[model samples]
Target: MSKSKTTIAKPSVLSDFKEITKMRLALSVVFSSLAGYLLGVETVDFKTLTLLAFGGYFMVGASNAFNQIIEKDLDALMDRTKNRPIPAGHMSVNTAFIIATLFTILGIGILYTINKQTAMFGAISIFIYTCMYTPLKTKTPIAVFVGAIPGAIPFMLGWVAATNDFGIEPGTLFALQFFWQFPHFWAIGWFLYDDYKKGGFFMLPTGKQDKGTAVQCIMYTIWTILVSIVPVFGFTGRLQLSVVAMVLVLLAGLWMLYYAIGLFKKMTEKAAKQLMLVSVSYITLVQIIYVVDKFIR
Candidate 1:
């Protein structure tokens, strides 16, 4: 009986850690940073890449843990978040705070070893996410706009990590991810409108599921697609994409755009969910294509 209890209890503890840190989300953020690093690097340094992966994950994980602590009460009010570690009674706020604090220290320290710019951006991402975005989520829809700042950083952070400089290359990467956030998040807002309302979060621009929201999604999708293709025009300096990669990138964006249009026409929860998934795939595919193009060209 004692052995069984220990075995079962271990998995629960691991699950709580996963919930508190939002493991999947943290990994995806790390992927973006790694992708950015790959794009800017002429010769890969596995040491720096490994540091980036761990440091980026720790940074994002810390932000998420702090966010959960701040929103513990609000999270319990919503179906989606009610099962999180803190709200579900699997972890204490104090414990989460301690974890978050340690992750923040480790994250910043690891990043600082790379360069000042990389560490600075990592610290900035955490501050904006926990201090600004978390608090604003309940008060205004503009929180999404503010939240996009940190969301867009990882991709660009990688470039700075690789080049140790902030230039058109990193700037273009920043612009690409920055514009992509609106449509991606709005689709989530559209689908989870009711759940968000329960937590007093006004996620959509108009705070409702309507054609107006869909129109903005369509508009931002266009902007994201346009920004993505800018590297092919040769103006973005070291971020240039070959014509072949540019065409492939265009097709991927159009695929996402098709789903966005479907959401507009259907105006249904299912359509919104489809758009969200497609947007995720679109970004990941675009990143892969960009890196592949850089190597072949």
Candidate 2:
């Protein structure tokens, strides 16, 4: 008798983790948190750093998972999101729900170990992102404003995790990110307007790719640039930015603004994509500059 052939199972654990966390997006959120923590803490504790990293991962993961769950149907409609685990049938809705809940609980518990305020912020981010922003995406363009609240929390959450309080330092970090999100997200909305339209998501202020929406994008980009340079005036308490760092950040912001202006003038998908890429680079580089300035100064 011929022996039956055996089939080996593929290694799926890592893939599942990546899918559950939306690792790329989670990493971006974690980077902002790390920058805030580094700026806030005079002396870094390895244990605290580890906890913050893990806590941020879980919190962002939970938010993304819940977002996917809520938008699964819409995801199916958009080419950009049609292949996500839930929408593509790689994961069941029930499984995704349980995973999201578990991650949220774990994230809050870990943050609570650091501080109650951090935990509260983590919970609030999840609540606002999942309950309010997710549903509002299809209803009104104001969802971006609601989403910015949660998006801005991670930056300040890091400072709270380090200091266990809300103060000028954390407030500044929050303000910087809060202003940054509008331009970053609006740039993405501009490029993905057709895709978003297919999914019933209204992301532009004017609900169409018109001068009004482009003008709003330009206004937000200007605000982001202004807030990014605020630290140069020594108004952010302990979160001061050196003149050199401020100049560097300002130059980067101007480059980003240039792309935003190009998008406004051309009103083409390519221009919007360029603006989106530049906006991402601006935020990431600004965070790095802030942390580096904190250490150098």
Candidate 3:
């Protein structure tokens, strides 16, 4: 008697690629760069915007791939990241390296076509993220501080992409996002404390989930809001905000701060999770408002 063999289905290449690139997160980062491009350019250049989007994605995508490869074993131990392609054995390390290398070249090359500084920042973001940040995650909580440098570069990268200059305006954009990262990241750290602990990453400022950490979240939220409103007061030449948009952006910031305050008061996982959600919404809304306000006024 002959028996038929059953064939196991493999995961689609698209899903594998998406997981490797972390497409959603990569795309969101690209949106920040896009917002900066829109704000910096007097006239919208669709072609450049399109290139920036692809370049930003590839840069960020490559960064994530390198991070996963570096942390594959650690990722497999954490509940939140255990299913990632590299950690789950769905993809090989060499394959990921190939994809990341190709992405790095394509992304930087595309950004270079716009301007060299833009490409330089993109390359720097990848370097800081993959080299400094990845290795430091297990060493100290300062890894978060190191990570934010690359994390915040996208906002300023857009301005440079448009103007090919690094001055007060791009610096202002950089400051806004840099301070914003503390609260946003700490909120995630608070809620995922145990999971992060399992993965040997201390993300909170105080090295524990405590009042000290919550207080810093509140403090940084305040700093982020203040920096966000600087353009409203006409503090920068490249970026300006109308009174209406200023009000709206402040409202969004307050919404995030409100949750940060909640985390400080209760210090509960639920509070931390809500704070994280609001923080994401606040950044996204603020970026949208900046672009819309620029065109409207």
> Which one wins on TM-score?
1
Could you tell me the TM-score of candidate 2? Answer: 0.95
Top-down TM-score ranking = 1, 3, 2
Q: Report the number of the highest-lDDT candidate.
A: 1
Overall lDDT per candidate, in order of appearance: 0.93, 0.87, 0.91
Q: What CA root-mean-square deviation does each model show from the true structure?
A: 2.5, 4.2, 3.7
Q: Which stretches of candidate 2 lie over 4 Å from their true place?
A: 1-13
For candidate 3, the lDDT comes to: 0.91
Q: How close is candidate 3 to the true structure, as a TM-score?
A: 0.96
* Residue-level lDDT tens digits of model 1 in 239-284: 9999999999999989989998999899999999999999999999
lDDT of 2 at 7: 24
Model 3: per-residue Cα lDDT over 1-297, one tens digit each: 001111223445567789899999999899999999988887788999999999999999999999999999999899999877777667899999999999999999999999999999999999999999999989898999999999999999999988889988999999999999999999998899999999998788899999999999999999999999999887798689999999999999989889999999998999999998888889999999999999889
Better of 2 and 3 by lDDT: 3
The sequence of per-residue lDDT tens digits that candidate 2 reaches over residues 1-297 is 011111222434446558767999898998888888888887998798889999999999999999999889999999888867777666788998998999999999998999899999999999999999999999999999999999999888889988898998898889888988887888789889999999999998888888888788888889988988998897878889989999999999899889888988999988988988888888899999999888878
Q: Against the true structure, candidate 2 has what lDDT?
A: 0.87
| Shift of residue 259 alpha carbon in model 2, Å | 0.5
lDDT of 3 at 78: 95
Off by over 4 Å in 1: 1-7
Candidate scoring better on TM-score of 1 and 2 = 1
